[model samples]
Target chain A: MMPAAVAEPMNTGTPLDKDASQADLLRSARFRMEREAHWRRLDALVTRAEKGGIISLSYDETRDLVEQYRQAMNSLSVARDISLDRALVAYLESLCSRAYLVVYAPQESLGGLMGRLLTRGIPQAVRRSALPLFIGFLALLLGMAAGYRLFIEDASWFYTFVPPDLADMRTPEASANYLRSTIYGDERHEGSRLAAFSSSLFSHNTRIAILIFALGIFLAVPSFVLTFYNGLVLGAFFGMFAQKGLGYDLFAWLSIHGVTELAAIAIACAGGARLGLAILLPGRRTRRAALRHEAHDAVKLVILAGLMLIAAAFIEGFLRQLVQSPILRLTIGWGMGLFWLGWLLFSGREKKIRRGRS
Target chain B: MTKKRTRKSGPRIEQFVPPEGVPVNFTIATLGSRLGAQLLDLIITYLIVFICAAGLFYGGMLPVEAETVLIVLLAFLFRIPYYIISELVWNGRTLGKRIAGIRVININGRRLTPHQVTARNLMKEVEFFTPLTMVFAAAAMSNWGIALLLAWVLAITIVPLANRRRQRLGDMVAGTLVVNNPRSVLLPDLVVASAASVPEAEMFDFLPEHLDIYGTYELQTLEEVLRDPARRAVTAEIESIARAIVRKIGYTDPVKSGQELAFLSAFYKAQREHLEKLRLFGTRREDKFHHAEGANADTAADPVKS
Candidate 1:
């Protein structure tokens, strides 16, 4: 008996023309017969690779696999173009894509990834964002100056600039003792108090940074406002403390954690502003393209900023309340500030080493 | 007649052709499935945090304050590492994506990079989680905060809806797509033998021109029509479809109404062979659109030429 053909007619319609149908059947049968071995071989190789990664294959096997993949892709293109068999075309398409991913996908080690990100990714992103960072700083400074001028001129300006819930230390009419207590906290319960403070501060700062970065898609206005508003609150509190003759103490207290905290916020704002600039002034690129290009750096900046906030939270929680000496606080604050500056500047620089032969 | 024309002309499947010439056929995942995957991931994350918190509480090793601090930090920072590590390890599929049978792929055809994974997952913090936080924050503040938060949520939600690719804000920003991973099995040759014994090819004869009129895409559609048991039961519908195909291909010989299905079956077999032969020669046709529109017109003018 002849091989029962898969394409058997559904019903007893008009008898098919035997000669033409037999010839067509022979062509299809021959086509499948010729290609079946290679197709089966490719399928087995792919299945094995999928089950136990490409690494399981030997070098020669891997080379042979790639050659098979190329031949299969050619088969798929040809099958798609000329073959009328849907099932055949579908099978080839699936095989080719799976092989493509297996052969072409990249694999990297964790240590290598960390090294590249640290050495090249974050630093380059930061450097690229210098202009936006500067703009963020300027906006903050302007807000601070405005708040200071307004508060010094009229005490009522304090209410406008600083929300009452957030104004823990420098509330109007608070005595010096109360102000000092707010900063140092109850000395006996310092550990728990600082932990709570740090957690809350971290959450607050991280949330704000994320918001600024997220809002940057809207042309940066909201980011600018939030940054300026943060500066205004800082200035209002400063003015209040100076008015109460605790200006030096306030500066000493803030310096320990404020440098890092402020820097993180500024960087976040800068990241947001960068996104805004991309949308507003896309240069030669389309708006979408510009936004996509800048978004990568902006996201990196936000990640860096988030890390900085975490560090600031650690310092604010553990170190700030425990240390009482104003001079020590000053020293630690300046040291951390300088350290960050130096790290940012020199961390990723490539150095050429000179060697002399004996 | 209208039904046949509509079935023949309508695009049956979605195809994304990348600019980089190599045809990668990926099925874009629906938003509902993607959201379902995210929901699963969210539940898993919460469960992890809950288990850790319970363990810390029962262990009694640390002070309450320290335990609370640890739990809070874990809750906040856990998602970042969870997403980054999973995607990097599993090649753009988290446990959630894996379970849902979807994967994140670089839309531009390059290998998924660590940077792209990190960027997309980090944006999720802003796009999804932070907005919920903002809503809570808004409840504490004036109406302006609520308005702002609502707008932010709406903006992110609308992005995926507006795009044909169904790319979320994170996907657009990161240049990735979530596609249903193709799952196919080796199929027996459709033209292989079956139980029914009908004459193989005498019902119809297709000229080269008739075979050339349609590419593999249309061929697949035609195969689907022939395979449908429901359509086969309705002889009137099948006859109409066969007639429409004949008309479109400009067959010169009139097909008897009774012979329409048989003609289609024979044409299917012949066209499959013709296409396979063409493929062996290294020439390819992507779909009907890939061929110049005028070729069918030229073939129609010279009906007997094939």
Candidate 2:
């Protein structure tokens, strides 16, 4: 028995007859318009074929051409030898031609491209690394608690060995002087090369922080270790400073930039951890495939972290050293830190409300 | 040139023959399969991510803050690119999906497009956070209960129940479907063979504009079957036949995979002509076979007539 031919419903929305209304086509078109599968296939074919010389149209060009074909089909009263299906095929071919044009188009502005990357790709990357991002935040909080415990507790185990000469790592009077210099901006050091060098060093350190976050994906183990090391160093630095009565001075110096810088560090670690997980245990996928998958996710977090580092560096240079009042420094530092944490956890990028409206 | 015959007889729905001799799964059986597969995937993915993060934490390379962020970030990103690349390169089945005897494809059994993968995975939050997931979590509370429940919901609700052969919520939103792919046959990891060198269009018999009807026949048939949304097992022979016809005259450019053949057939019905020819041939051959047998039977019954 011969298989039967059934005229399935057309998704084009364009009526074969002259009397077909816009609403008629629109009803069907909604399904096709929103059909990612249809558009995606069309996009792939057009892009792939454009790699060859056969299809050479750009994205907009292809979209316009396809629209035109649909319009042409709608205008016609009778079905000529060319069926609706045939007309669609022609439009797809045109679309492919346009995609090819884009593939072969000349490379454009880096700044513009980078902007697009940040605007479009970064959010996706952030979303992908959300798991690690959350965990990393928790780790940051824990690390801070650990630092407080190690530095503030007078009877802490690390401080058990008391050397008479090491009793004063900082002096109360010297700390007060440093605090004054940080807040009032020491006129003596203004416009000096030493200030410039210090600022540069601060910037350099932040960049390194960004790189650590980015490269953590390459090797998960190292990224984790580096993050832990930073925490340890921070604990030791504060502990040593406080023992000598310079804790107030250190707070004024660190608070301005520490808020943003510390957040960036946590974010970077999250990005790195995202990549490492894909590598260490790929579930059912081979390690290579999992790694590649994880790396893309990590890259997004790294970029966001990079932005944070830049912000931190600017604050560290301009505000940290200039801010002499320890109380003021504490307020600003804690406020910024709290704001960031709140944004990261509950800002909720769902944007579903906007989606539902559309 | 062979003229393709149209199957124009009135609709006679045969008791829907299961394709490729595969059994039709009932609702219970299909749901069981989907649920089982989801659990497996969830366990595997979480374990991998947790272990890696733990190793990194212990290694001391990742700082405490970084480790916390890493955990949150990796969990979400795990399925995004996995879905995207697998759909594009591996034709929708990740290694996990392949192991579980399921794969994601277009509504019309075609290799997944990158857009489809991105769309489906992007909306993963919806599936994971769907009310159904919440209900399931309440039913299965534990430390990993929420995550495990979500994983199961994805497999159960988003995956096509074996009986319906339609879409799960994720598939519906993403415009993709999970099909049974026993052996994961991937599209060639196509290299940019002609990257700077634009190969001249090979001169074929058909011109780009002239082949307007290109894949209409195949496209129309595909659309018909897909509209019904039945999860019918496609036979290898049928796949080849459809693909060969579509490739020969569907578009000016050639398609690479059988999945592509099925895909193009939905949008372009020009290949319907070729399909008609196959139907005609099958019918004619069957008639001839019966005729010869009848003649042979007559001869045996009466030798003089022979």
Candidate 3:
């Protein structure tokens, strides 16, 4: 266990200390003398970065900061290896961490991040959960079919399926003409409280989407149920409209934004479902690691969902009111739906090939 | 892992080995300190929410719809972003953490990313706020519901206790760590004053045979005794210790009257050089009583040849 350096002198350099402790101190003192300037410069730069952020530094300073940071990091390792001066080591540790914070911090700027997320991040995430996304889509479709059947058998079943707040004017007892006017908005909602209700509804929908995704972490049952329940409400509304032979008109009206809106919620639910299933079947990874790994993609999908919802809200608020023709409305609805489907499916697949080749 | 917590109540040391292969050590923030920081953050966030709510309800400056929207917005807009943005912009410190001298760092020794910050903060909604609200909201509803809510809250509360790193669910999921900020001061170099540093005295020297009698423990004791600020008035104490060391080591040198300090300094320097040359470091030595064991540790502590 013992080194024989004690029996034989391993004093390779300058001389032994007037003996050892002083010589060792002299070595560290010399170490400090050689590198103290860089540490001091880095400290000042880091203090400035902390106060104002990386943006405040000049280009030259940021460059210098990185060079000095690496120098400090190197000094830290050397100090640990040879020096026993705890205080010097501690100072170097603090300096390196501070400088590391500045240097390795998220390097993408806001606009850059946005561009990447929209172009690659969202689509890639949505693409990864293709199976869950399809399952979510099927859940909504099945719920719609179930609601339509239940309402056709008995109009009174609407109350059981559709909550009052969302039911609005499309009641079973309401006249066909009145229902038509509400769908087409015959000067009723315009110049009125449209702004208030529209914003409120937008916020409500987005909150529900986020909640669906958040609740997915617990095994995705809640998310799936909520998505199904929402589908039922929509189907029940369509069923009531069909009773008056305005089914086609209602489809057109809903399609203007419903395609985007429904799909967004389904995507969000799919994100949650991914998280939920990750907990149950984490595969080879630890449960925590699997969940975290899935969560990264899931979060990207959530962001995509929120953005799509906003896009849907704009269409619902504007195009849904202005457009009267069912044919054109259906076209716009299906067109937007296909756009998202194609984008999510194919947008980022060739990202590697397209990148750096140019 | 925490064998490094040598004192009964010392801060735990966590080491991170970055890709550069330099393993740096950081002092993990204590649980009590983290709780304090959380409490401060909660207070700060609540104040912000309270201020915004007050302005919305009492300001009487906006239309009814706008006020309602803003009041609702306070929950979404302020509290969540306060934690996220502060951590992101301040490089892993919220105002509370900055004040408490702690920071969130990536466990891998990388810089904190926005995604990491965002993930951890978002989990706060699920981990802390939701459980807390469930307890308060369900308390009046049913005994069963209250019990379930409390259990949920309790489970999350004990998560940090489950690991040596004190990571909560959020921290685990996000791969971040909260550590005590490094102590930040470069101390002056540690060198025993040679006779040249003082006026009118030349140095004393000791041979390896004379130096080898003492180990690191005694060297440290000698160092403290000589470096003590009040040594000026304790000349007799210094002289006695010097004479005792000379007698023990059997050094054949005679100390001039006032030069006991010089003799001890040289012996101290020589003894440390001897111990370090053997690579006996970092509390591996006690005193001359265990010179044999110290010798064993010296070879063990030395690095193997590459």
Which prediction has the highest TM-score against the true structure?
Answer: 1
**What TM-score does chain B get in every candidate?**
0.63, 0.41, 0.66
Give TM per candidate: 0.78, 0.35, 0.71
lDDT string for model 1 (B126-226, tens) is 68887766776775877787787788888889999898788886786678888876665666555543112335345566667777777666777777877
lDDT of 2 by residue, A1-358 (tens): 3212222222233223323332322222222333424445545544443233223566776676455434323322122222233333334333432332233222222346455545456665565566787766666665555665665664343343333343344322346555444335664433233334344544455444544553453446556666765665566556656666566767766776787787788777887677567666789987645655565556556556766765676665555656667787788777877866555544434553465588
Docking class of 3: acceptable
Q: Is candidate 1 or candidate 2 better by TM-score?
A: 1
The numbered model that scores best in DockQ is 1
Against the native complex, each candidate's DockQ, computed on alpha carbons, is 0.33, 0.03, 0.24
Candidate 2 stretches greater than 4 Å from native: A1-131, A134-187, A191-203, A342-358, B1-306
- lDDT by residue (A1-358, candidate 3, tens digit) is 5343332223424334454533334455457767898899999998888778888899999899888987888899887665544457778988876676666653325457778887888888887788889867877888898889999998888999987877886689899999988878786545224545555556667767876776676678878998998888888889999989999999999998999999999988898788788888999999878887887887787778878887787788667777788999999999999998898887777874576486
lDDT of 3 by residue, B1-306 (tens): 333333557667787665556666778888888888878988887788788878767878887766655655555555455788888767788888988999898877777777777667766766766666676677476778777677767777788888888988778667789998764676654343443453222245556567656655577667667666598458899889888988998887578888887666666555654555444344343357544564665456445211
Worst 10 residues of 2 chain A by lDDT: A2-11
Candidate 3 Cα deviation (angstroms), residue A217: 2.8
lDDT scores of the candidates, listed in order: 0.73, 0.47, 0.73
* C-alpha-based local distance difference test score of model 3: 0.73
TM-score of chain A of each: 0.81, 0.54, 0.78
